[model samples]
Target: MTAAAACDTAALTAHLVARGLTASPAGVEIHPLAGGVSNDVVAVRAPGLDAVVKQALGRLRVAEEWLADPARLDTEGRALRLAGRIAPGSAPEVFDLSDGYLVIERAPDSWVPWKQQLLEGTADPAVAGRLGSVLGAYQRATADRDDVLREFGDVTAFGQLRVDPFHRTIAARHPDLAEAIGHTVDVMAASRVCLVHGDYTPKNVLVDPDGERLWVIDWEVAHVGDPTFDPAWTIGHLLLKTVHRPAAGAGFAAAGRAFLTAFTESIAGALPIDPAQLVRQTGCLLLARVDGKSPADYLTADERPRVRDLARRLLIDPPETITDAWELLA
Candidate 1:
């Protein structure tokens, strides 16, 4: 193996040994786990055993200057357990994890971050629909548990992520965009309560090897907020794909529409929410990218002038219909 890959294996084996999951290094093998912005991951292999080990770092790998929260590491485990509880196998099973190291059963297949797949036109719309259902069901199951969620009126954490950095910085940097962003700030600050995967986006999901099942990963950003928040958050990424990758934009838009139709239809009458509100939330979700602290992925990239246009439009002049807005992918 290349020296870098070998080093990754050795490092992870040492970590697993320290975690007491593996006592010896002789049988264990490691493969570098690829993807994501905030974590370092390695896949560990042994006879009749397969799992992934993830660790949190102070800075992102792609841009070593950006700092991130270690407390969010603890959130991953909480999210995994909560997801499994809501849907028996919506997430992979974890054998053991601590503040720094997390070990969980590895899905035995090559998978693409749903963002990459969507950008490539290979991601399935059915999976998007399932994602909606899974998220919706999870929210409905926890909606009434006030004891489970201590706060409903505040968004200190949300402000830290969506407001402080992403949205606020843009307005501060671009004076012309201030008025549009100001409006989004008010909408985000007025959020409702429901279980939210704060970072609900395509990059965090993996399709089962057989392509029949879908799995959502990364729960470090889970919070209790408006019920339709996750849908708006996810659909925003699909909207992003449409703007950034011309070839895959059509597929991404199709998935967003299908996912929304399925999500709203599945929860019809059962939900107390209005679809228009969700659409408004989506515009706010898009604005949060510009006005919030954790900016969308496109903001960091050098190319794609259209994404800048879309972001401005979503914030400055959002479409009246989610479907009409979704067609931007075409």
Candidate 2:
């Protein structure tokens, strides 16, 4: 199938009208949402519709020449529906999925990216806990389900967007850690446990300040694979924030604890995999952000080595649990 045209206000407006999605397409306003690199996401407002339309890009908007199948939009549409069932209101509701584009529910206009909140140092424990609960519920509910596995079994997109750009790229750059990173990749490939939100970072989450609603957006990389990847991304990102601002380390550490505690509690049993696996994944994730295709823009030149050193230590001598990983921040 041919890929759709790149998403822009004018093209999207015509697409919506052509699909008979709105009678007053003239009044339908589309504004591009910033912060994503792999797709064009826009907020749409019409006479009776308030939604977000997303179309995948084969070549991601990063400095590196990263590429993935745009058909992953179909995977996202399916994942959103399933996640909405597992953890209602935690993900965007899919409305239409076709022609290599997706239309889905939009968070309230007032809602902001959770990344913004963390960057500003709010570090609300409640928000952190809720994120843990949602992720935990999604993983626990779908763990080892054959039907889910059948639908989301593919990990090609995950490889392109995550494993390759992250694990492989970093391994090449840091050959000293190649053996350990290779094992992590092998273990992840061998797993068929649950639905992994491959991009479960703060930037993908939207929240309302009133403490009322939270939406985990961007499921384009969702796949059924290693369950540890989601929590690793979350904890890894919090660790990044801690590294970014050591002055607010205490609050960030508290949020990480709350997140991990809620995740384990939501499982309501022994952790599915060894806790050490979480640490290992977090270590790899840390290395990826600092040296992989997309380094964090927030960190200063002096801070990059700090992050690199932390990642190296984590890989060589990993902490036993996610909570223990925070001590390395010092």
| lDDT of model 1, residue 73 | 66
User: Each candidate's TM vs. the true structure?
Assistant: 0.81, 0.95
lDDT of 1 by residue, 47-165 (tens): 55589878776666543245667666666777688789888877888878774777888875775567767766575888888887787777767665775476333345455444555
Measured with C-alpha atoms, the lDDT of residue 211 in candidate 1 is: 55
Best by TM-score: 2
Of candidate 2, the 10-residue stretch with the lowest lDDT total is 1-10
Local lDDT at 185 for model 2: 94
Q: What's the lDDT for all of these models?
A: 0.68, 0.86
lDDT of 1 at 201: 82
RMSD of 2: 2.7
TM-score of decoy 2: 0.95
Give the CA lDDT, 0 to 100, for residue 90 in model 2: 91
